[model samples]
Target: MTAELKLALIHSPTEPAQEAAKVLRDRYEWVPIEQATMAVALGGDGFLLQTLHGMLDRRRILPVFGMNLGTVGFLMNEWSPDLLENRIERAKTFTVTPLRMEIVTVDGESVSYPAINEVSLLRETRQTAKLEVLVNDRVVMPELVCDGVLVSTPAGSTAYNLSAQGPILPLDSALIALTPISPFRPRRWRGAILPERTRIMFRVLDPVKRPVSAVADQREVRDVATVAVAIDRASSLTLLFDPEHALDDRITMEQFAV
Candidate 1:
């Protein structure tokens, strides 16, 4: 990085993050978030995701450098109080495009949202959700009886997707994981990996009896009758990481953990 590199430091509202932000502010002069070339996010993975989504919503292309201060910081780097500029200079860049979720409700309301993790459809009632899975306008599964289902990006494979028995995807893999949460029928059926560009559609079999909700990361729409999900390659978010501990390396390490 050049000496003229101006950084915008933003931290979560958590106490630890606020404290660290004070320390950073005392040592370095920061610029406004909108005017800076890059951003320094101080918090956990959740905050990082929030920052990314906010940027995506505004069509801002600011690259983020995340330093973990929260409990779970899988997407964050180890925090340092000293020589922060040098760390960013040595960091690696990783670009990821988010999924666009087009949701339609039973009332005929339609909305679209962007998700960096996975677009999931979950049952709102105690009743099991019955869904018809379609890919590229073709019926793949006529009916899937389960608690929920999700389409996960490579970067989010290890998150809620993993807990739902979804496959873990490599960072650079040009594929997405389509996994069911808990299947009442088709007990033996495992999820499939589709090409990253594939368009996935899920239709609620009985929206009135079995209410279903579609969620794009944090943005959620209730009583969704149909949802179409696809990767939005036109826009992308870039995150920075230390070369020795890049996102690809972290994802690879997750696969070996017991």
Candidate 2:
């Protein structure tokens, strides 16, 4: 049944992706994205995230199969122009639930963004940021002086979370990582792993002196006074991968990486 499934071909503007698109277009028939049952994305992890975010914005979720044409294609499969339909038919499927970040600025402006990977709060100036951590409306840490903090989903644990020494979580773990960027007070406190359903909050202790910015994946909001993060099960996304290189398998393998 791939023949019966309408497919949409989306590619990044990079030369390699553009060139590959030309080859795939000549070999297969593709419909508009709005009419497609599934989509094939060409590029690296960044472009793949962009495509997924686009779908979220349009409220048109589609299972996407990504082929790597950029660096660090952690979310993409090996690229090949031949037998794409067969590849898609045989591909393994993984469901990913994104995090929802709600922010309130010092000026009282509120905005929300969805992050497929992580939502990080970073110090906007040289002064260290001071934050109060809360879980389910209960204060956990009254004062945390740090460069910043981030809440990462299992899908994002291997990215910036790992870089900041946060634990890598299995894709099916149903857990989230609360990691501090560079803690100054309670220096020994590292990070925590919480149930996916938990609502995490961070309150800026000194917005006037130690301004902070919050980033939901690539989107950022400045001078945030408070931030809330939680898994948005309603906006779950699906990704397709070759059986031999499935995303869950890749995450498991990362734990053993040198």
Candidate 3:
């Protein structure tokens, strides 16, 4: 009912996605993002994240149904050209709250960015980054001398976190994964799992020498100082998935993937 009434078709810059968009638009009369009840996105995980961010940028929170057309389709569903509307009508929604990264640069300018995946702190140069970990304003690690670190949501634990040898979390779990990038001094520290609402903070021990940057998904803030990260519980995005291939199911299956 609502899926057929008002829907928008958005795609990435890839040739396949553009071609798919043309075919979808030709078959279905979809409206713009501003006037749509739901949006059907084409492309891979990166484009899907972009689409979600675009919606948040406009302060619109419509449901997004993503079709895979990229290398890694971790956050996308299988592409079906037939009965797109019918599939959307039967789709299940999963609400994902992004991590809010508050970054203050060397100039003391504070800015906030929302990450749908994970917020990673990376070394800018050849020098190893010295980072101090804080949880709820309490010091956890006095100094971590290594590449960098990150805080990942259950929705993102399978992405970069898994690649970094971090634990994979179930989608519905009310927890976050704190994983280290590469540790030299503290080789035994395997990171921690905190509650979803915990305020995890990272302070650069010698920011001037180390020069670590924080990335909130793809949005990057360069240079200096403290980075505070936490889930933005006030805001969330609903992603639509086919019943048989839901996000939670995928997350569970990923743990078993060899």
Which candidate comes out best when scored by lDDT? 2
Task: Give the CA lDDT, 0 to 100, for residue 156 in model 3.
Answer: 92
Candidate 1: worst 10 consecutive residues by lDDT? 1-10
Q: How many residue pairs clash in each candidate at the backbone level?
A: 0, 0, 0
Q: After superposing candidate 1, which stretches have Cα over 4 Å from the reference?
A: 1-4
Could you tell me which residue pairs clash in candidate 3? none
Greater-TM-score candidate between 1 and 2: 2
Query: After TM-score superposition, what is the CA distance of residue 67 in candidate 1 from its true location, in Å?
Result: 0.3
C-alpha lDDT values of all predictions? 0.92, 0.95, 0.89
Using alpha carbons, what is the TM-score of model 2? 0.98
State residue 151's C-alpha deviation in candidate 1, in Å: 0.5
Write model 2 residue lDDT over 126-222, tens digit each, in one string: 9999999999999999999999999999999999999999999999999999999999998999989999999999999999999999999999999
lDDT per residue for candidate 3 within 1-258, as digits (tens), equals 354569888999999999988888778888878888888999999999999888777788889999999987888988867898889888999999999999988779898989988999999999999998999999989999888898999889998988888889887888899999898769888889999989999998888888999999899998859999999987798999999989999899897899
Evaluate residue 147 in candidate 3 and report its C-alpha lDDT on the 0 to 100 scale: 87
Poorest 10 consecutive residues of model 3 by lDDT? 1-10
| Model 2 weakest 10-residue run by lDDT | 1-10
Better of 2 and 3 by TM-score: 2
All candidates in order of lDDT, best leading: 2, 1, 3
